[model samples]
Target: MQVSSLNEVKIYSLSCGKSLPEWLSDRKKRALQKKDVDVRRRIELIQDFEMPTVCTTIKVSKDGQYILATGTYKPRVRCYDTYQLSLKFERCLDSEVVTFEILSDDYSKIVFLHNDRYIEFHSQSGFYYKTRIPKFGRDFSYHYPSCDLYFVGASSEVYRLNLEQGRYLNPLQTDAAENNVCDINSVHGLFATGTIEGRVECWDPRTRNRVGLLDCALNSVTADSEINSLPTISALKFNGALTMAVGTTTGQGKIFTSLEPEHDLNDVCLYPNSGMLLTANETPKMGIYYIPFSKPVLSSSLNQSLPPAFL
Candidate 1:
């Protein structure tokens, strides 16, 4: 999507800091004001009232047609059409949105995981269903084959919610102190979890076994110096085969080759089709790097093709 200027983007205003009833009343008043006005005049009025805030999380739809973002003050989720760069709709939430997953390509099914342990299901029209988990969730991954939603949190267990059965199954136990983020490999169906103790653990959902582990801190340390503290694994993304991108609290972005940008990364995303790696740090701007995978690097240990060097 090409955005030339900020003024070209339209974000609907929620009138933050107001109660739900008051906000609804204000919206009704606006609707009534535009009821008899000319269509062109109403469009001009809407173009004048745009409120931009800090977005906590943002995700592009599978079909690349829409963008979903969550922001605070009074927590709200907004959907924007890529072609128009205009707000399609916005929904206010009871609590802050920790993360969300779009289940369908047409923006039909969505699941929002809140900081208060509440999971809300939303349809294209509006809210559909709701449930609660046991602990505060950090991240989640959807396994399409088994139709299970795996949630990891501040605890050592990964909670499994079966969307097909409409209930949660048994939680998967991990050896880490806390699970930070999880990602499922699209090709081989292997899911990996990044832990607070600086380790990435790979698992097989079919067998429920811990297949492999990578110690980030240990691998990062030079032969001459020792690490004072273990950097927390904050974000993870699997691109192709078993190739993964990892981000840490120490401002390290790794895919075999380490990159220290000196800012703690909030998230990392890989666009394998375009060979682009996107990393969001604590700063206002984001970093986009190119991954040169002309021929995948071979690893003697794993005997598989690894992700190539970054540029």
Candidate 2:
């Protein structure tokens, strides 16, 4: 997906308008103030994988070489090389997997969520360790790579997991809700967590603290008034360069930017623009959230007005 001019967010000629669902047409039309946002998809695949199991969650790694897919059907975590789009490794877990990730820059190690009850960290060959979190968890993220600490967004509160001690530590509590944590996405210094509610939260990894929060209620706020209600965030990704793509379970998406400094690498031919943040929903039933968007999150004064995925 080609990002438009400097700091501008033009939905790359992605899927056509007919791709959006019928229910979203009126609500989407009224929300996006502009006329149809022209999108031309260079590549398109409607139904991706064939499985008796449905997708639990999808993720890309820090090094950007692999796509980690985890799900039910006596669920297992499978790793796939990004460019080759071929299966790299598949570990058959005794239980259904809810979330999975490749934590190393070399993609040497794996971390995963099992039944949202157990946390497992394994070597490439699946010879590794497992931790049964005391509380139930929906999703998890590893921060401060050198350390064994992981941010666990449980159904109620967020707990810090230390692999060194193999238990919970420094548990900073949230409101009284256990089934809140929906998805967790992290970059190097920062991370974001989504909930079953309309809230998307940001955090500081160093201090294990909350930074800020955004209410994505579809009807809360619009250009003039609130547009849509709280959107159910399905996926969250930190696509390096300090930007995140927030995918909702509903047929929609959003880009969250990082307020950080940029480097002037005059030595290279690379045109430094804002980071790339792209996401998608089931509207088109793509079953993949790896769509590309090179535009930076904060680089835009450009209000996003794009065509629906399936019209």
**Best prediction by TM-score:** 1
Q: Estimate each model's TM-score.
A: 0.69, 0.56
Please report, as a residue range, the 10-residue window in candidate 2 with the lowest summed lDDT: 261-270
Q: Which stretches of candidate 1 lie over 4 Å from their true place?
A: 1-52, 223-228, 253-311
Candidate 2, residues 39-137, lDDT tens digits: the string is: 222333322322344445555666676655554465666666756656677666777665565667645677767765777777755648777776766
lDDT of 1: 0.66
- Model 2, position 187, has a per-residue lDDT of 41
Cα lDDT, all candidates: 0.66, 0.49
Across 1-311, the per-residue lDDT of candidate 1 in tens digits comes to: 11122223222211111122234576675765566343213222111112244456666688877766676657887776756756788889899888888888857888999999999889988889889989899899899898999999889999999988888898889999889889998888898999998899999999989999999766655655444667778767775694676666665432344334445644444433443444544443333444344124312212322222100
